[model samples]
Target: MLNKVFHLTENHTTVKTECIAGVTTFMTMAYILAVNPNILSAAGMDPTAVLLATCLASFLGTMCMGMMANLPFALSAGMGLNAFFAYTVVGNMGYPWQVALLAVLVEGVIFLVLSLTNVREALFNVIPISLKQAVSVGIGVYIAFIGLQNAGVVVNNDSTLVSLVSFTDHFRTSGICALLAIIGIFLTAVLYLKHVKGSILIGILGTWILGILCQLTGLYQVDAEAGYNSLIPTFAMTDFSKLGETFGQCFRVDFDGISIVNFIVVIFSFLFVDIFDTLGTLVGVCTKADMLDKDGKFAKIKPALLADSIATSAGAILGTSTTTTFVESSAGVAVGGRTGLTAVVTAVLFLVSMLFAPIFIAIPSFATAPALVIVGFLMFTTITEIKFSEKDYVKAIPAYLCILAMPLFYSISEGISIGVISYTLLHLICGRGKEVKPLMYILTVLFILKYIFL
Candidate 1:
């Protein structure tokens, strides 16, 4: 059954190798389990509950990806989307945690409906290639930003226009450590390009050892108090009867406040970001794995989309934020995860990590920072696929904008928003609007107006 489903023979990867890939992928991504709860707890949800929900949703979602999408990628509460939930929805928008969860639920249901129907595939077809590349670059920058911040390389500057680097004090230590990591990643990439086996796993382990060395030598300190604890699935007993009540109270949307304008804006924000994020992840991973169909669509995208939407809705009910497909799955793809075996491996590893959450949590973010930065560099390779030419400004400008805006705007959704808006406006002005599909035009305009004005 594994052979038939996973195509292990066709891919020339043994169960042993696939299992190793799966384990490596899990370790590389296990940071989400710790980090997501930290971010969401600050938004007022029960930290323990969020942890359980994240684990279960990640397992279920990745399992679906294995059985249905037959791709090696795994799904989880995405880094960017969760930040939006915590910071933007709960912190800035003044919504309660439960209400934010409800919004996630609504978005999930909509995603599920679209996925089960043909609309999901239709929408995937219309997205411009440039925008897809933009998402890749944006995610890269965002991941890099995460690494720098976690390493304490960048910090808030009180007097400057924005935060600046902590150049004076921690420079020598953090700089040397980060440099070692970067060198490790580069060596791994070179080996990978040369077709060396297990290069990624080796590179990651090497970088981790360097971090441990830094800690032991007093160059860095490990926070031993932040130990890991096992995650037990407990949301099965939560009184979902209050789901509606909890949601309503959290959002505080009175009938008088629910104008057509606000409702449309909220809906558009949720839909546009989720759709494009999923689309870009799918395209980027598919491109890396050579899984794109001749028509430039992922053949099994429907199930993948359904899995993502279901994961997000499940996360909401379990008390968390929007769950989406992670761009980091490209890491697995880059290392030869071409079949469901890869995803199944990833899922099994996530399930096991639940048993050792404490150990998983114990590893400092700096330890994982190397993997994040490394994956960012790997995904950044997609930029080479973009065509650069005098006549290509229409595509190039928006793409470049998206690449740059992700880190600057500090939000993948915002970067995508700007990219789509730029793409649509440019195409229209250049008399090339007919080249873009009608649905894309409509969605692009709606995203721009909703995000910008409303």
Candidate 2:
């Protein structure tokens, strides 16, 4: 029955191989079970509730990818998008978390409609290769920057904007946390160099263990006033009833004091990042797995996108952030996963993982920071694929601006807006206007209008 459904024999893989691949994929990406709730909790959502939402959304979405798309990829609440949801939308912009979820829901619904039509593909093709690669690199840099701050390794400075942690100022609290995080980054990097699977997850646990030792030895102190949490992890059995905190919260948006134009921008911002991020993951992972056709197109692209869009909407309704295809799915493909059975196995694991929510919710930012830094390196390495081409500098300039703007400006939408507007203007100046697609022109105008008005 498995062979009949997933064509396992035809794909040259076995049930055992697929199962192992699924386990491997889950191990690598399971850090999300810990990290996502930690991130969304900053937006004032209940961490336990976010944990349940992540588990359910991952199970349903990954299962859909298996049964509908018949691919080895898995879905989860995406890292960069969650940061945007928590930090940019809720923290910086001062929007309520409920409204942020609304924007995510709208983006997901729009994405689904586009997936069912040709618009999404058309938009995908219209963006230049350099810019697409830049988007990933930008998000990588942005995530790494966030990780540094989370680890307390980077601190605010009035004169220079940012500086390293003052080891002497908070010796027993923030200082020790920063020191452990720095050590964790080195440990994780060495593991990656040695080809260790689940290196990121291991780094988190290792750092947490080290922290516990420090706590016991009087090097690390717990002081709630100093923002230092207990290094110890509580292992209480998971409470399933906490799902009520976040469930159906997306529909509870109150827009009484919200600006209509700003709301539109928020929705578009989520849509833009998610659209390209998913497409980029699909292309890169499938290409490496040799799952693409001779024309370099993913055969299951349509269904894969549908699964991603469905996951995003489901995650929002479940009271989290946008869920999308994880780039870490490449881990499964690298381990010989080639069929939906791998994804199905992964989905079951996600469902089974919900019972461990207590531990997941306890994982501190300092512990997870190493995973973000490592995953940032994984995403940032794709920067080599951008084409500058014959000193024209037209393409590279806009891509460079986009890459720098994301981390510096602290907004992915700003990077994209600058990239689109600059790309269009540069091409027109160079007599290469014809290369700019019609939709590209439209986007350029809309982005310009956004700056002028909003």
Candidate 3:
């Protein structure tokens, strides 16, 4: 039944392989179960409610990606979008969380309309093929940078903006965790080279076991205020009724004191970021998996976008930030997940997490950091497929900018923005204007206006 539905055999994969890939994918991204609540809690939300919203929304989105799109991708509350919801819109702008969720709901509806009309797909098709491959490589660096940050291997510096962790301070909590991450990186890389099945998952569990040992021996203390918690796994019954707190709150928007212009801007902000982030992740991951066709497009893209739009709208109603396709799906793709069965497994795990939230949430970021770092390398290797000739330098240069901008700017949308602008502009300047499509001209103008106004 599974094979007939997911076409597992057609994708040259087995149930065992897909299941492992799904589990690995979930393990790597399960941090959202821990993270989304904390971030949304800052927006005057119930942490427990946000956790429930996250799990349910993710289950709905990922299931859509599997059953509707038939792709090995996962969806969850986006990291940057969550921060924007809590900090920029609600905290700084002084709008209530309800109004902010309304903005997200509206944005998702807009995306749904655009996707249905093929507007989003048209925008996606205009991007040059070389730039798409560059997006893959850039996401590699971008996600790797994220892993380093999450593991405390990279720290912020007032002067330089980024620096390595000072091993001298907080040695037990910060220092040892960072060290384990570095060790995990090496361990995972070695396992990958040895061609071990489930190497990435093993790497995560191994690093987590090391952390548990540290905690058990009193080497790693529980410091909740410091963002360090007990590594030991525990089981508990979560208060399921908390789900009612956040559900359907987006519809309860109170517009009593809402500024019309500011509200529009907020919705546009969510729309712009979610559109590009979802598309960028789809293109980049497809590139790495060799899933794009000769035209450098995902064959299942319409449904994928539809699924994303559905998830976003559902997420808003569930009282979370925007939901979008996750780049961490690359971890599964890298591990040979090629069918919807992988996404289904991931979806099932998300459903199970509502019951075992604590155990899954306790799987710390440092443990999963190595898998991302390793998968980034796997994705980065596709850089060799890009053309680098003199005549293609116009394409290559923009691709290069796209690659660097992602990690440096810390936004996938920014990378796509720069890529589109530079690609179109450079081609025009090089007397290759005819090479740029009509939609390319439209996108360049739209992107330019976005920077100027929004």
Candidate 4:
């Protein structure tokens, strides 16, 4: 039954290979188990609840992709979108957590409509190949930077804005967490080089054990006030009574006051970022896996996109941020995954992970930091294919800016905006505007309006 449905033989893969690919994919992305809550909790949502939602949503979302689209992609609460939800929507826009979630829901619904109507696939035709490559590389740097920051390898400096911590400071002041992170980096890299399956997962587990020893030997200090200091997974860590607190709160949208503009801005930001992120991941990963059809289009993209949209909407209702297809799903692809069986295995792992949510939530960012950094390096392999000749410099420049602007400006949307706007202007200035599509022109205008009105 499994062989017939997933076509294990037809894809030149076995059940064992699919399962390994799924496990590999899950290990690469399991950092989301900790990272999502760490980001979303700052916006006033319960970290435990976010952890639960993250797991459940990931399970459901990936399952949909596997069953409906027959794709190996996995979905989870996205890193950049979650940060945007917490820092921008709540902190900058001053919207409550419930309202932020409501914005996510609205964006997901819009995305769903677009996906179902096949508009999402059409929108991708206008995106330049350079920009597509740039998005992948940019997200690589962005995620790596996040890992470095979490591991205290990169620290905030008043004078420089950000600076690297000295090696001495890393071991002495940053304590056992930093120590574990450094060790995990070397260990995971070594294991990955040796072609070990689930190297990232093994690296995380090894670091977690070292952390436990640090705590037991009185070498690790627990900060109770900041809330995350436990070495074990526990359900008692968060308030479960607040599980459904953020659900169905879209009614809290206030159209009466000046808040209407802010609401629209927030929703628009969510929509733009989520759409592009999903598009980029789908294109980049599918292309890497050679899953794109002969016309260079994703197969069954409409259904795949609908699955993503449903995940995001379901995520908001589950009291978390935007859930979308993960770029890390490419980890499975790189390991020979070619069908929904990989996704099914990954989804089952997520479902099992929910039972150990406490351990996942308590995992200090440092332990998972190495996996992220390594995955970033892996994703960056696409950079070699971009054309950098004199004639192609216009495209290359925007692509380069897109890569740098992501980590430098600290937003994927900002990076994409910079690239698109630059691509539009350079083409027009160089008498190459004919190369830009009508859809590209429309996107350029929307981004401009975003700057002016939003």
Q: Please tell me which predicted candidate would have the highest TM-score against the true structure.
A: 3
The most accurate candidate by lDDT is 3
Better model by lDDT: candidate 2 vs candidate 3:
3
Q: Model 1: per-residue lDDT, tens digit, 182-261?
A: 56657666767787766676766666666667655765543335331222122233322433433323345344433455
Report, for every candidate in turn, its global Cα lDDT versus the true structure. 0.70, 0.82, 0.93, 0.81
Whose lDDT is higher: candidate 1's or candidate 3's? 3
Q: Tens digits of per-residue lDDT for model 2 on 1-454? A: 9999999999999998899778767765676887788799999988888988999999989999999999999999987899989999999989999999999999999999999997766665566766776777776787678778877999999999999999888788888888999899999899778977656657878988998899999999889676677767676777888889999988987889889888898898888778866876675566456675654455688889999999999999998899998866765775578999989989998998887655544556677677667766776776776777866589989988988887897766677778889999999999999988799999899878767865
Query: What lDDT would candidate 2 get against the real structure?
Result: 0.82
Ranking by lDDT: 3, 2, 4, 1
Q: What's the TM for model 3?
A: 0.99
Q: Candidate 2 vs candidate 4: which has greater TM-score?
A: 4
Q: Lowest summed lDDT over 10 consecutive residues: which window, candidate 1? A: 227-236
Off by over 4 Å in 2: 1-47, 70-106, 225-227, 249-300, 324-350
Residue-wise C-alpha lDDT for candidate 3, range 1-454, written one tens digit per residue: 9999999988999999999999999999899999999999999999999998888889999999999988999999998999999999999999999999999999999999999999998877878899899999999999999999999999999999999998769989999889989999999999999999999999999999999998988878899999999898789979999888989888887788889998999999999999999999998999998888899877899999999999999989988899999999999998999988889899999999999999999998889999999999998998999899997899999999999999999999999999999999998888999999999888889889999998
Q: Candidate 1 — what's its lDDT?
A: 0.70
User: For candidate 4, lDDT tens digit of each residue in 12-121?
Assistant: 88887788878878876777887788798899887777887888889999999999988899999987789889998888867788888888999999999999887888
- Clash totals for all models, in order? 2, 0, 0, 3
